[model samples]
Target: MRTACFIDGYNVFYGLVAGTSFKWLNLPSLIQHIVHVEAPESQLTSIDFFTSGVKPSLASRGSQSKEAQDTYLRALIAKGVVVHYGRHQLEARNAPRFISKQSPPSRLDQVAIWKLEEKETDVHIAISMYRLASRQASLPAEERVQQLVLVSADTDMTPALKAIKEDFPDLRLGVILPHREGTKRTTPGSLKNHSHWMRRLVTTEELAAHQLPERVPTKKRPAIKPEYW
Candidate 1:
């Protein structure tokens, strides 16, 4: 089966790699391995990674964090993963303040905050998936993508999956949640309901085995792994 993967990069980062040693991920290799485990005949044809650039002012490591993300993105590009960039919007907003677990948030007890939103990623992924499915409808059977795999636990993508499942019955859908093994994150029922199969967690061993090399060669200069990563 010819398969295409759509990855929610922001979702993957916070769910799997953040605060972990696996920041330097080899996404294609890891995804291929997982897909093969689910369907031995699957041939990964393409990877579309959707994400927003880091805001250096809000990042924990400031500019270093942004540089690390840039380097990693360059390495991913070198490996043939097509990246789609969304943008971050920083704005002053007001929201209910957190008190205690037992206390409900009251509108009167609001606080000023800097709200950072990642824009257009969900819509982009949905549109891209639907467009691919529509395009495949015109292709020769052998040239069409037989499978569509989504790598995210976000329920926002459920509608797209459901639409594909309804409109393209021949195309198999798969979902891979970015939750790492040993974590207690719940499997999203909506995503699983729309997908033909759902992989619940990614093993640490898989991440350890699929890290990018310290240096990745580019046309201009080599993209090296960040020292802090």
Candidate 2:
């Protein structure tokens, strides 16, 4: 069966950026890397990476950091990963250092921003799952893709996960989480029992060799490597 990989760009970023030398990752090559490690010689259809474009309101972290991010993202596109850029709307975060019920709290002059729901990223993942599932359903019985691999830690995807199974009984559905070794839940036999599915946190070793030789690749992985998709 034809197989495709769908990645939650932020989920992946949060999962891997902890220890890798490079902050950004190569989406398409990362898939090939994972496939080579887990199921070498298998057919790979396409790599879809869903990420938000830089917000116009993005606070400047100065020039050097921004340049690095731009360079890394560009490299990913150059390598063939489909990049989906979306807009960001920052939400208010309650600073722990200060608080109030009715009166205003003191400003420490420290500014911070966060989003409870990164709406764009969530929408992209949901939309992709639906679009691909629908597209597969529209194909001829024998020509349709029956394998989907999703990489994310968002609980938002659980509904989509269940729906895919019911809608496409013949299709194989799998979930891959990006987290460090000690960060994951204690293994259930299912994760171990699942022959065609799994949950993995990204490892530093994999991060170092984002795009590398398929056979006998360098094993000089990082010391605090985290497991990955």
Candidate 3:
């Protein structure tokens, strides 16, 4: 049977950026690796990646530490990873953060940075799954996508996933957990509706097998001001 993979770029990336300090993985190649682990019996027909186009440095986080983020994201696209993007968001509000009053002591010499939060990533993922699901079910006149496997932890996607399972039981829809700290999705009634959540993609050591080519990265992640705060 033909299998398809979908990735929630923002959801998965946020987990890595928050939980761990390392952020170097060949995403396109990563999907290739995930294909085998998720559907060992099937070959991938598509791997649609969804995310917003905003770089963290200037948008919300303002962290130059995220310098290589755009670089790697574009690299995935060059390798033929399907990328879906949403616009960056801007809002005005009281942005409270932590700051040290150096007068206290050396331990109090730090500052906190905050910015507007954009929430279009989840929307993009939902739309893709819905579109693919509809295309797979209704048999689109334009294209035909076989099986679908959504990779993310956003419980918001539960409804769409359920649609595939109930409406198209034979469609082969599965959910993938975003964080892979040896953790698993355990919503009390999550699987009661559908038990198809898989683990995250390839580990760090196996990055070589999943990296996109060398040329693409240089183009997508251009020379933007550093994002480190």
Candidate 4:
């Protein structure tokens, strides 16, 4: 089976890599491993990774964070992954101040804050997936992507999955939630409903084994792993 994978980069980072030692992940290796395990007949043909550039001012590690992201993105490109860039928008907005979890938020008690949103990523992923499905519909059976795998836990993608399932019954759909081992997270029912199969958790051993080399070569220079990572 010919397969193509779509990745929601922010979702995977927050769900699996945040506060973890697996920052230097080799995305293609990991996804290919998962695909082979789930369906041995699958031959992963392409990967499209959607992400926004990191804002240095908003990052915990400031400039270092941005630099790390740039390096990592370069490495991914060098390894044949197609990257789609979105953008971060920081705006001032009003929202209810959180007092306690027991107390419901009231609009009367509002505070002004800077809201940073990663724009266009979700829309981009959705449109890209649907577009791929549409294109595949016209291709010869041997050239078409028989399976489409999504590497995300975000429920926002449910609608897109639904459309593909409805319009292209012959195309196989799969979801791989970016939840890590030892973490307890509810399975997204909507995504599961649309997918032919779903893989709920990624093990630490799998992550460790699929990490990129300490230095990844690019056309200009070698992308080195950040020391803090």
Candidate 5:
């Protein structure tokens, strides 16, 4: 069975890699592990990773600089991970801020701040999943994708998965929940309910085993791991 993997970059990062040293990930090996252990008969044909680039001014908000992110993205590309970029919608708005308890009860502080929201990643992932799943209709039976794998815990994808499954009853659907250690509920109920099978991603053992090399040799300058990563 030929399979394709779609990963939501921010979702995976927040759920799996945040506050950890496992930022340098080897996506192909991880997918291979999923296919080998769960669906032994399946073959991984491609991996689609969706994400938005970060801004340097927002570094205080736990975002990496564009240069650092680019290096990591380059490494992934060299490893055959297809990356789809989305833009971060930056906005300024007034948000409430807490003041000292001694302040008047009726008084509240409205501070102006900049907020960054990642857009289009979820849409891209959902569209890609359906598009790839539908390719089985036109391609030769052997060459078509027999299984569609999602590496995200976003419940927003449930409707798309359900629609695709209704159209392609024979296509296998799997979910790899990107939950990190200390997480209580890894898989969202809606996503899990729609998937034929589900698995937890970001285990310590698997992450350590699937890290990209410190230095990924590229045709141009090498894609080196960020020193602070």
Candidate 6:
């Protein structure tokens, strides 16, 4: 059976890879490993990676994080991963955040900060899934994709999944939840409820097995992994 994998890049980052040593991830290898573990009969045929560029204001630890991300993106393209980009937006609004430990909690205290948010990524992922499902539904069984794998913990994708399940009853859908802290939520109920199969977590061992090489050679230049990553 042929399969396609759709990844919500930021969602996976914050849910699994952030603050971890697995930043140099190899999407192709990851998909293969996932398929071997979760759906042995399925062959991964495509990968769609959705993400946004880094904002300028954020202070980065290593050689600018933006450069590192660009390098990674290029490497992914070299390996046949389709990259769909959104944009990061800076918003100024009054919002309540966790109180600082140094200061006493005050009910009236509010802070106005420049919050950077990635926009359109979820919408893009949803639209891509819808299009893929539509394509499959329109084609004959032999020509259609048998399975679609979604990697994310975002609840925003639930509606898309539900619709696909309703419309393409024969298509197999799987959800892979990025490994998350025990205190934090795992997969959203709606997403899991609609999927044919759900893998609750991505283990560290799997991540270790699928990391991109420290130095990835590209046509334009050598793409080096960020030292601090």
Model 5, residue 152: displacement in angstroms?
0.7
**lDDT tens per residue, model 3, 133-164:** 66665665335555677777777777777766
Indicate which candidate wins on lDDT.
Answer: 1
lDDT of 4: 0.94
TM-scores for every predicted model? 0.98, 0.69, 0.67, 0.97, 0.89, 0.89
Candidate 5 overall Cα lDDT vs. reference? 0.84
**Candidate 2 lDDT by residue in tens digits, 115-197:** 54456777677678767887986788867776777777767676676676667677776666777555654433333333267
- Worst-scoring 10-residue span by lDDT in model 6: 178-187
**Candidate models: Cα lDDT each:** 0.95, 0.61, 0.59, 0.94, 0.84, 0.83
Candidates 4 and 6, the one with greater TM-score: 4
lDDT of 1 by residue, 79-152 (tens): 99999999999999999999999999999999999999999999999999999988997899889999999999
Candidate 4: the clashing residue pairs are: none
What is the TM-score of candidate 5?
0.89
TM-score of model 4 vs. true structure: 0.97
Error of 2 at 174 (Å): 2.1
Model 6 regions lying over 4 Å from their true place: 97-108, 137-141, 180-184
Which pairs of residues clash in candidate 6, taking residues 3 or more apart in a chain or in different chains?
Answer: none
Consecutive 10-residue window with the lowest summed lDDT within model 1: 133-142
If both were scored by TM-score, which would come out higher, candidate 1 or candidate 6?
1
lDDT of 5 by residue, 15-36 (tens): 8887778888888898789777
Poorest stretch of ten by lDDT in candidate 4: 136-145
Tens digits of per-residue lDDT for model 6, 1-229: 8998999888777777788898888978987788768888999889999999876458454438778788889988878899999998888976655667887756577778887888999989888888888887567877789899999888888998998899889889999887654435645798889998998877777878889998777777877788877
